[model samples]
Each structure stands twice: as structure tokens, then as C-alpha cells.
Target: MTEVLVVGAGPVGLALAADLRMRGVEVAVVERRTDPGAGTRAIGIHSPALALLEASGATDGIRERAVRIARGEARADGRVLAEIRFDRLRARHPYVAALPQSDTIEVLTALAPPVRRGVGVTSLRQETDGIRAQLDDGGEIRAGVVVVATGWSGRDLVYRPGAVRTHHYPDRYVMADVVASGGPVARVHLERAGVVESFPLPGGRRRLVAWAGTNEVTDADGFLRDAVAARTGTPVDIAGASTFGVRRAVAPALRRGRVIVVGDAAHEVSPIGGQGMNLGLLDALTLAPLLGPWVRRGDDAGLARWERDRLASARHAARLAFLNTMLGRAAGPSAHAARTMALRTALRGPGGEAFTRAYAMRFDRAARARG
Candidate 1:
């Protein structure tokens, strides 16, 4: 029997399968699409994720192709509000690594088993011993556990009705990656209109994002250039751009009998803070070791603990993403000033280090230790 049958071959699924194989667990991965590596959707991999990814030996490859963001700045109205240094974060990798999602997938794919592309799990049925999965290509897979990592696209089919709750935000934004010179730092400009964020990528390129304040955008390149110049006084030569809205979704439970859920399938958060993908990667990292033992020995205790702790971590990440989204929206002068003050206080002295650790997603580590 296959120890673990991963239902999606995305980053999360690949990471989980890779780590499980490293631990000598039998695993198989299936993807619904033949090609899932098309976009640069997520770009920031915090220290916690980097540290967790070290087990699969993909962290070094990722870092080699990523820009290490050592610090971040918060500015508003042409004045510096606060500077948070990531070097102070207590982790093996003390910086946020910025790389296109495509690059990240490539690195992990090299380490994972051959993914069965163009194959999908149409349905899952629990058995007395193992779970049986029906594939879209008239095939079947029987495994000790089925992990749903198909992300938001597979939420409806993998989860029961009323199982997952979703909340959509009114905020809209446009972002693009272009050839530009930038340092190893990230910037968040809290303008009177909205927040403008810029991050350094590999190959001397930079990713720029600007909030649109619920307005429909027709010209992405024009809007990105105008917003960056207007808010941050930086002229950006954008080759192209894409617009996206934000939302938060979470399932109260991550496990249902022999079937389990991970990544965006279990919890989907806003992209403002760049925690959604990292949370999912960390999910795979945290679950791999526990899942192996359960699959081999039927040790349900570890899986129980894993579900409880993962749910707590997902909730905390969602709350953090919510705060980040709210803070980036358009604000008045007084509100901006208050936000700056709060940021300044939080990003100073001892609190600065603590905030950096929190932003690096050390809460999961702390929770695991406490558990």
C-alpha cells in the first residue's frame, strides 16, 4: 500500500512527498493539470519556511536563486516610519528569501518523486484499512492517507459543504515584476491613497505592488507606474502587470477520518504579508515526520496532535494576514499617522526583534515546542 497519496502536486504536496520519501515512507503525488508552474504568484519565503525546507535539501537551491531580504522599511508621506531588520530573527535562515513561485516549484520538483501530471483524484472513499481514491483518468489509488493540497481550486470537491468558511475583501491591487536595480531590502509605503510594496528578486529584478482602492483597473502597467511614482516617488519601468483581489478562508478542522488537508486547501489567507504560501510549505514540513509514523504504525495520537497544532497555527496566520491587509488599505492622515506610530513602536528595540520573529513565522515553532 502507498503510505501517502498526495492529491495535488503543487509546492505543498511536493514538499510533503519529498520529505516523506526522505524519511523512507512510500508516497505518490498526482496533479490535476499538466502544467501548474506558470505565474510568479508568491515571492517571499520567510525564515521559518526556509528552515523547515532544509530537511528536503531544497532550501540551499532556493536560496541560490533567491534574493535575501535582510531588512524592511515602512514609510509614509515621504518620511521613514520604521525599519525592521530581519537579521535579528533567531533562525537558521535569518532573512526572507524572495524568488518567483515558478523557481521555487522547479527546485522542489527536482527533489520530489515524479508527479503524475494530468491525473486528479475525483473522489475519495474511506475503507476499513486504507482510503481508496478514484482518479479522473479511470484509475484508482489506495493509500493509508490522502492529503488534499490542490489549493483553492479543489476546495469544493475535497471539502464538504459548510466545512470551509470564506471571506472576500473589497480591496484590489495590481502587481508586476520588472527589470530594476534594488538592494536586499523590502519597502512598504503607507501613502494616503494606499500601500505600495516593493521587494527585490533575483537577477536584479523587482516586484512592485500598489493598492487600487476598490477601483477597476484597465491599464495595469499605467496604474503600477503611476501608483509607485505617486506614492513612493520611484519611477518603475513595467513591462507588464496583473491585478488580483484578496480573501481569507479557513477550515476549522484539517482532518476528516483517513483524509487530510494541507496548504491552501485547509487555509487560504491574504497575500499582503506573503504568509499564505509559506504557511502551506510549513504545513508540509511539519506534517511529514508525524505522518510517516502514523502511516506505518497506525499511531493516531501524533496525527491528532498535528491537526490541533496546525489548526491553531492556521488561525494565527489568518489573523496576521488580516491585520496586514487592513493596514495596507487607503487611510486618512490621522489614521496613517497612528499606523506609523504603531509600526514604529513595534519595530523598535526588543519589540523589533520579536516582531521580526513573528513576521518570519516563528509562531509555529513556538507552538510545536509548547505542545
Candidate 2:
């Protein structure tokens, strides 16, 4: 039996596998994708998340590939609502960095020992000794533990037996690419018409996620022309585009006997704070220290402990996401006015500084990992 079997080759799966191997646990990563990769997807390496990456000793190269977003500003009608000065966050890295998830998955996956691609786990059954995973072709894997880091639809289908929150909104969040003509880092500009967020890419291209203006990628050439003209004040080419339904969800239990779920498989954070991936990475990192010894020593109690420890953290992330998405969809006159006032208050004196620290995710004395 393998020490651990990791499902999915996404950021969280790759990260969990790498961390386990680094700690001397034998691991096998199973990814059904013929070739797993993402394009123009999430890569906001927030400070707190970056600190976790640093601990893994795998962040330096990824850091170099990312553009430092030392501040995050929100604007409406081109008027500033809130600007978070990340320099004040209490950490060595006090800012957000933008790197595509594709690059992130590649970097983290390459760090793992190896991957079992093309093979898929169809169902999970807990046994007295370990857990049995039935694969697509009726093959099976018995492992001391399991890690589920699968993405949206897959997790929804696989983890339905667990606590499931099917939260969907009619508000379609359109994400596409556009050239950055302004400053570096990242910016979120909101107008009565819509919201537009721009992030710098490791490559020359600048990525834009917008909810307003003419939707592009609906038609490649036409979308490119429309999106480019909208963002850079000139027509631009389409690098990539994808639309997804984002929401909050948590597996009923972080663990069921020897079977375990972490990352998006356990819970999903909405895209508002860009915390989904960040929180998922934290899940992997946090589990390593807490569960490593158990996997190494082959102790069932250790596996049990991992389940209990991961529950609270996953739940908090899911709830926070639910609230953020709820607020992001509301842009009525009153909500906008209230938001403006709140931003102004949070930007002044000590309040602003405190808010900035929180925004940067530098929660002082707050333990982000398992105790």
C-alpha cells in the first residue's frame, strides 16, 4: 500500500504530494487528465500564502516569475474606494503576486516525485486497514491515506456524500485577457456598469477579469478586438479566456475514516478575496506538519488526528467565501455608497493601517496552520 494517494494534479494536489515527499512519506499522485494544466487561471500569491510556499522551499523560482502587487485598490467610476498599502503587513513579503495557475501547477507538480496520470479513481471505500480506491478500469489502490484536491465539477460529483453547498448565481463573472497599459501589480476598478480587475503576467501579457463591457472570447477575433479596445484604450489580441461558476463548498468531513479530502475537494472559496487557491495551498501545507508523522509511522490515530485538525480551518474559509461573493454581487446605490464610506474609514488613521494588514492576510498572532 502506498503511504498516501493524492487525487488531482492541480496546485493543491501537487503541493500536498511534494510536501509529503519532502517529509519522507511515500506518495503517488493520481490525475485522470491526459495532461493536466491551466491557462490564464488564478495565481495570486498573497503574502500569508507566500510564507507557506517559502516554508516548503519551493517558492523562490515561482516568486521570481510573479509580479509583486504590493497594493490592491478598488475604484468605482474611476474614483478610488479603497487602496490597501501592503507594505505595512507584518511579514517579509507584504503584498500579492500574480502568477498563472498553469505555471503554479507546473512548478509544484514538477516538485513531486512522480504522477500516475491517465489512471482515475472512480470510488472510495474505507476499510479497517486502509482505504480502497476503485479506478476507472476496475483497478484499485489501497493507501494509508487519501488526499482529494480535485476541482469544481469533479469534486461536486465525487464528494456529494459529504456536505455539499451548491451555491450558484445568475451573475456570470466573465474573465478574459487584456493588455495592461497602466501600472504594475494589480488593480480592481468598478463602475456603475461593471467591475474590471487586471493582473500582471509572468509573460508580457496582462490578464484582465471583468464583469462589464462587451464579453469577448464568446467569439475569438471579435472578443479580442472588443476586450483590447476596452482595457488598453486600443484593440488587443485574445490570449485566453474561460468562464466558471464560483461558490463556497465544504466536504461534510475533512476525513472519513482513512479517506481524506483537502483543498477545493474539501471546500471552495469564492473568487472575491482570491482566497480559494491560497486557502487550498494552506490546507496542503497545514496537513503536512500535522499528518506527516502519522503517514510515516503508519499510525491510524495519526490519520484520525489529521481529520480533526483540518475541519475548523476548511469551514472558516468556506464561510468567508460565501460572504464575499454575496457582497460582490450587490452594487446598488446604497450598497455602493456604504462601501465608499467604509473604504474611506478603513483608509484613514489606524483603521486604514489595520484594514490594510487584514487585507494583505497578515493576521497578527493568528496561526494560519495547524497547532
Candidate 3:
């Protein structure tokens, strides 16, 4: 029997397998996709995650292709309200590393074992000494432990009574990646209409995200361009755009019998603050260390504690995402002014550094202590 069978070959699963391989643990990876993806999807790797990924030698590769965002600016009506400098953080990786999800997967894939492609786990059944996983390929694999690292959509494969809870927010946004020159600073425009955000990308490209109220938009590019030009006075000629809604999901228990869950399959948060992937990556990092002992010596003392700590981390990330979406929501002129003043006060001096640290997801207990 395999010691550990990891489902889903996404960033989280790949990361977990890589960490396990580094520790000399017997790990197998499976993915539903026949071929690797090519798009630059999720784009932020924070300090905490970077520290955790150092063991797998992924941090250096990610930094090579990523744009380091060391500063964040909050503006309104063409005026700067406040700024958060990540460089002030007392950590090894102070900046939030921005790389395409595709690039991240490539970096991790090189470190993990060969993944079995075009196969999917249909269901999982807990056994006395192991878990039996039913695969779509008409075969079953029994492993000492199984880890479900699939994303949010793969929740169905491991469904149990009261396993997961989900909630969707009414917020909507239009975002797009374009070839433009925006310096390596992340800028947010808190306007009366809504919020307009811009982040620098590699190869002279930039990403723009603008709030679009409750109603859906058909012409995402036009709406985004208008929102940016009207609110931030910056005209953007985008080739295309996409719209998405935010949601949060959490599993109170990450493990059921011998089968465990990690990554988005275990918890999912809004992408407003770019915390979802980092949270999952940290999950893999923390779980990898514990899985080694459990699988090798049957020492499961840390499993319960790991679950509790990871649950708390997920809740904290959800709260942060909620705050991010709320702060960027549309407001009246009076509310906008009040919010601007509040931001200025909150992001000033020492508070700004603290905010930057938290935004970079340094509060997770498993993260390395800052020097």
C-alpha cells in the first residue's frame, strides 16, 4: 500500500508532495487534467508562504519570475490616502511575490514526483488500516493515508455529512491582465463609485480589478476601463476582462479517519486580498511535517493539534477577506470621506507596518517567527 496518496495536482497538492519527497516520505500524486494549464491565474505569494516553501527550493524559482510588491498605496479622487510598505516588515521575504499560477505550478511540479494524469478520485472510503480511493480509471488504491488537495470544485469527491460549509457574497468585480507599464507598486483607489485596483506584473504587464456592484457585467473590459479612468484618472486600453464573485468555504474537520483534506478542498477564502492560495500552501507546509511522523511511526499525536490550528487559520483568513471586500465596496461621498480618513489613521506609522504584515499573512502560528 502507498503511504500517502495525494489527490489533485494543483499548486497545493504538488507543494505537499514536494515537501513530503524532500522529507523522504512515500508520496504519490494524481491529477484529473491530462495536460498542465498555461494561464497566469492566481498571482500572489506572501512572506509566510515563501518561508514555508524554502525547504522545497520553490521560493527562489518563484522570485525569479515574480514581481516583488514592496509597497501598497491607498488613494481616492486622485489623492493618496495612505501607504503600506512591506519592506518595513522584519522577515526574510518582506514583499508579496507576484507570479502567475501557471508559473507557480511549473516550479512546484519540478520538485514533486511524477503525477498520474487523466485520472480522478471518484470517492474515498475509510478502512481499518487505510483508506480506499475509487478512481475514475476503474481501479482502487488503498493507502495508509489519503490527502485531498483538490481545489474548491473538487469537494464532491470527498463529501461526508457536515464535512464542509459554504457561503457566497453578493460582491462582484471585473478584472483583466493587460500589457502596460505600472511600476512595481500595488495601488487601490477608494472611490465613491467603488474601488479600482492595479498591480504590476512581469513583462511590462499589469492587472486591473474594479468593483462592479451586484449586477453582472457583459462588457467587462469596457466597465473596467471606465472605472479606472473615472475613479483613478488612468485610462487603460485592455484587450479583455473577466468577472467573478467571491465566496468562502471551510471544513471544521480536516481529517476523517485515515483520509485527510488540504488546500482548497479543506478551506477556501475570497481572492480579494489574495489569501486563498497562500492559505492552502501553508496548509500543505504544516501538514507535510506532521504526515511524515504519522505515516512512518504511527505517531499521530500532532494530528489533532494541526487540525485545530489550521481551522483557526482558515477562519482568520476568512475574516481578513471579509474586511478586504467590505473596505473596497462602493460608498456614498460622505461614507467615502469617512473611509478615507479611517484608512489614513489606521495605516499611519507603526500601524501601517502591522497592517502590511497581516496583509502578507504573517499571523499564522506555523509561520517562521520574524527576527
Candidate maximizing TM-score: 3
Candidate 1, position 323, lDDT: 87
Estimate, for each residue in 1-371, the C-alpha lDDT of model 3 and write its tens digit: 88999999999999999999999989999898998788776898888889889999998999999999999898887888788788888788889898788999999999999999999989888887888999999998889899999887677767765568788899899999988777899998889998888888888888889989999998998898888889988787976689999988888788878888888898889888888998998888888988878977899999998899889999999999999999989998889889988888888866787778788888876665421
Q: Which runs of model 3 end up more than 4 angstroms from their true locations?
A: 161-163, 368-371
lDDT of 1 by residue, 141-180 (tens): 9999988899988776567787788999999999999887
Assess candidate 1 and give its TM-score to the true structure.
0.96
Clashes of each: 0, 1, 0
Worst 10 residues of 2 by lDDT: 362-371
Give the candidates in order of TM-score, highest first. 3, 1, 2
Question: What are the models' TM-scores?
Answer: 0.96, 0.85, 0.97
Q: What does candidate 2's lDDT look like per residue over 52-97, in tens digits?
A: 7665566886777787777767665556666777766667677677
Q: Local error of candidate 2 at 269, Å?
A: 2.1
Q: For model 2, which pairs clash?
A: 163-252
Better TM-score candidate (1, 3): 3
Off by over 4 Å in 2: 153-162, 212-240, 296-311, 330-335, 349-351, 363-371
Q: What is the model-wide C-alpha lDDT for candidate 2?
A: 0.67
By summed lDDT, which 10 consecutive residues of candidate 3 come out lowest?
A: 362-371
